[model samples]
Target: MEKKKLITDDGIRYDGRKLDELRPIKFQIGTLKNADGSAYVEWGRTKILVGVFGPRESHPKHLALADRCYIRARYHMAPFSVEERKSPAPSRREIELSKVMREALEPAIFAEFFPRTTIDIFAEVLQADGSTRCAAISAASLALTDAGVPMRDLVSSMAVAKVEGKLVLDVIDQEDKQGDSDMPMAIMPSKNVITLIQMDGLLTHEEFIQSVELAKKGCMEVYAKQKEALEEHFKKTMDREEV
Candidate 1:
């Protein structure tokens, strides 16, 4: 079988987006009534929902920390999320992503304020197009805020990739599978702090620098949308209360 050309001479990708262009993104806050806080996100064809429950007491006493609340995170994908049905069992990638999600979000929240408790983040990917981890972190941050978790700042994340020798932003599944590199990053937008960053594949020093700059630009766009969605969510809530 012949390989598909990922990029054209005019810098258009196979999906008809230019290099550095992101897939369509949408966010909805407080999607679940039972959860303390919740959010749903759609990036391109990828969809993920995150729910936050607690600063409640830790179930196992030994798991509680005297100084700060423990962060318990889980990342799971539905069996029918991808074209090929995923196994219901948690895979190694899911376990790793869960840990990564925790770390990415921990720096934003003031865990010390709620001692001997646990803040649970449940992220479910209903579909997987690409950059699911980045979308998960973005949605999880909003869920934290919706749960009334006080935080120093919110995290926004995005991915950068190199396909057919052209660097692109907001990588999709096709690009990631065939591309030369994939770098996912999370940052506290207001504080200018990087909470999580990981790169796979190869890049030169120059390309790495360029990719970081590009990723930062993409993350800022995500951050702006996140804030806009939150503002809209709160506005609707207030309007409903007034009615």
Candidate 2:
């Protein structure tokens, strides 16, 4: 991989990181009182909040299954999340993202343990500077864990982009739009399994494989942080109970 510039002669991509570097991520679990679980994640300028509810009765008709709980995810971008205000309605893009998010999370969660029930995950983008979808999935997993939902492994995610013909680990908004390729992947690291993947733009087969490898590497870092957050959340809960 060759490193080049997205802006400035310094050869730094946007957000001032070298290629193969991820944006700084900050996450917190158990942030909501109403939902069974909730979490917040911030990467670069992108911020997302996720709420997990259920393993409860399924409403409506035809959607419910007797064998296992339904996994539903909603990914929404707030009007103020972008530079221009976006519509409040769940557009086609939002719906598609939601569907993809659900698939990413389903394998990690033990949905079969809650037959005839439903698990609903709602992710809202508070600010988007790209990589919001990846962040959303990561946040949703944390929220599910906070809800005490049984999961095979914590799902962690990261993105890689081709900037100036060089593969970069994470792309901010400007670099993403200008980049030649963007690949996002979510993984159950302990299981060594990929739960979700998405690609846009173009890449050779070799580039694609390399991108996947790099994304997995980034996700491992994310997984460690997520685990730490979970530990801290439980510690706080235990302390509060004791007090």
lDDT of each: 0.95, 0.87
Model 2 segments more than 4 A misplaced: 1-11, 238-243
Cα-based TM-score, every candidate: 0.97, 0.93
Residue 69 CA error for candidate 1 (Å)? 0.3
User: What's model 1's overall lDDT?
Assistant: 0.95
Off by over 4 Å in 1: 237-243
In lDDT terms, how accurate is model 2?
Answer: 0.87
After aligning candidate 1 to the native by TM-score, how far in Å is the CA of 31 from where it should be? 0.3
Per-residue lDDT tens digits of candidate 2, residues 145-218?
98999999999989998877778886688778778989889999999999999999999999999999999999
Clashing pairs in 1: none
In model 2, where is the ten-residue run with the lowest total lDDT? 1-10
